[model samples]
Each structure stands twice: as C-alpha cells, then as structure tokens.
Target: MTRRPNPFNQQAMEEVLRDLGCPESLIPSTISNYRLFVPLLFTELGEERVYQLVSRTRDELTLGEQEEAWRSSIKYIVAWAETVMEQYKHKRSNAPKSDSPDDKQPRLL
Candidate 1:
C-alpha cells in the first residue's frame, strides 16, 4: 500500500494555526494539542466524520459572540482544526490510488 502524507506534521500544523490567526505565543501549544488530539479523533471517528464535526464546530464558533475571552482561543483552535481537515481532504483526493496486484500481471515469456 502507498503511504499517505501525514496532515498532523509540525510544519503543517503551524501553518494552519497561523492562517487561522492563532496568537504567535499560542502556536506551540496549539500544535501540540493538535498532535495529541487530531490522531485520536481520526482513529475514533474517521477522517470524513471528524472533518464534518470540526467544520460544524467552526461555523458555530464563528456565529457565536465571544462573551468570554477564552472563546476567542477556542475559535482559533476550531478554525485551525477545520482548515487541517480541509487540507487532509484535499490531499486525500489528490493522492494516487494503489493498483490491485491483479492489475499488474506478469508478462508472458
């Protein structure tokens, strides 16, 4: 089987956090959280389901007013998660599918 690209790599996580307007100071911890949480989410819920969940959470966060200061941080995290899921979906779609062994029959002598 072909190896899939890891979406939770440090560089990708940093980029997503930055793009989501995460505070520079918070980037490290956010990435660390992603490293720990995202894999578990995928393992338990599967990628597509996790993507859907994160997307919904992001939208809800976006719509709700940030009455508490912590809500802003939560928004950033949810947005980052949604973006990472989107990138994963894009990469998954573009990745080449492995061919079946039967599709590569040996040539006759």
Candidate 2:
C-alpha cells in the first residue's frame, strides 16, 4: 500500500527547489520523477531496493554515460515543464485580467 507523501518532506523539497532556483514550471515533473524514484513515498519499493537500483544504475555507467543519462532525463523533464508553463500562460491569458506579466516582475523589498 503506497503511503501519501509526507507533507513535511514535500515542504523541504519545495525549499530545496527554491534554493536551487528551479522555476515553478519544473515543479510537477520534478515531483513526478522524485515520486517515481523515491521508495519512502511509494510502498511498491523498499529502501534496500531503491538503494540497489541507484547503485546498479550508477555502477553500470561510465562517467560520460552517467552524464548523458542525466542530460537525457533533464531534457525530458524540462520539456514537460515547458509544456506546463505554456499551458499555464495560455490559461492566465484567458483568465480575468487581474495581474499582468508587468505585475509579475520581481518586487524589490
């Protein structure tokens, strides 16, 4: 039985994202990837299995292969995020005029 994600960890994840300067668009794909790989949140895998999988994946790859794998995964996630952002922008454009991008400009406080 899969457990719900711990709200506390989720908050920490958000904080990490903010610290790393990830855009809001990347959040969903990042969450999805994390959820898929993290056994703590998914009952389908135990910690040992998760560790083993990570270890095996790492061990099988050369340095360049590992880097390429990272790039490919990031590329897919970024594409997902871009689509999300595009839809969000489209929806906001059609939404009631409340805040424009000009208003979205970073505030200096």
Candidate 3:
C-alpha cells in the first residue's frame, strides 16, 4: 500500500526551516529528504527532545560546535527513520492473509 503525505507536517517543517534560515529554493527537497521524517522522530523521541535537537541548529554557539550538533541530530533522525521503515515493512510482510472469499468482497443482501 502506498502511504499518503502529510501536508500539515510538511508546511510546519517548511516554516521551521525558514525560521532556521533554509533558502527558498531548497525547501522542497529538504522537506522530502530531511523534514518529512520529523513527525516520526517526534513520535519516537517526544516533542521536547526533538525540539531541543532542532534548537541546536539555531544556537549562537561556536560555528563548529553548532555544525556538529546539527549533523549529529540529523544523523540520529535518519537512522531512526530507516529502522522504523524497515520494521514497518517487516510487520506488513508478516501480516495474516485473508482466508475467506467474503473477506475480499462485501456481501449484498
């Protein structure tokens, strides 16, 4: 089954990136590549932890430290996304198959 995209999270992440100074031209690809996984990350780690991770990208710390923090956070999120996707695929593959013909069609009285 194909998964539907979530427009609300997409728009919210775009706004978050804009607030963090992401360029206009990069928003679409960035949303697909990075920000789309944010909802899952928030679900797995909670809003406060995810917010703290994102907040590091905007901190006024030394440049290298900030970059390191941002990269590490992104790495964590990407890894988690991969793991979750894999688990979803595995569970879907293991789901029980319908055994009755009626399971595939609605009955009419």
Candidate 2 error regions (>4 Å): 1-8, 13-65, 98-109
TM-score of 3: 0.35
Point to the candidate with the largest TM-score: 3
Model 3 alpha-carbon drift over 4 Å, by segment: 1-65, 99-109
Candidate 1 ranges beyond 4 A from true positions: 1-67, 100-109
lDDT of 2 by residue, 39-91 (tens): 32323443344444545676554222454565555455545545555665688
lDDT of each: 0.63, 0.57, 0.65
Residue 9 C-alpha lDDT in model 1: 78
**What tens-digit string does per-residue lDDT give for candidate 3 at 23-81?**
89777777665644654654576535554666675555323445466657766656677
Q: Global CA lDDT of candidate 1, please? A: 0.63
Best by the lDDT measure: 3
Using all chains and alpha carbons, the TM-scores for the candidates as numbered come to: 0.34, 0.34, 0.35
Residue pairs in collision within model 2 = none
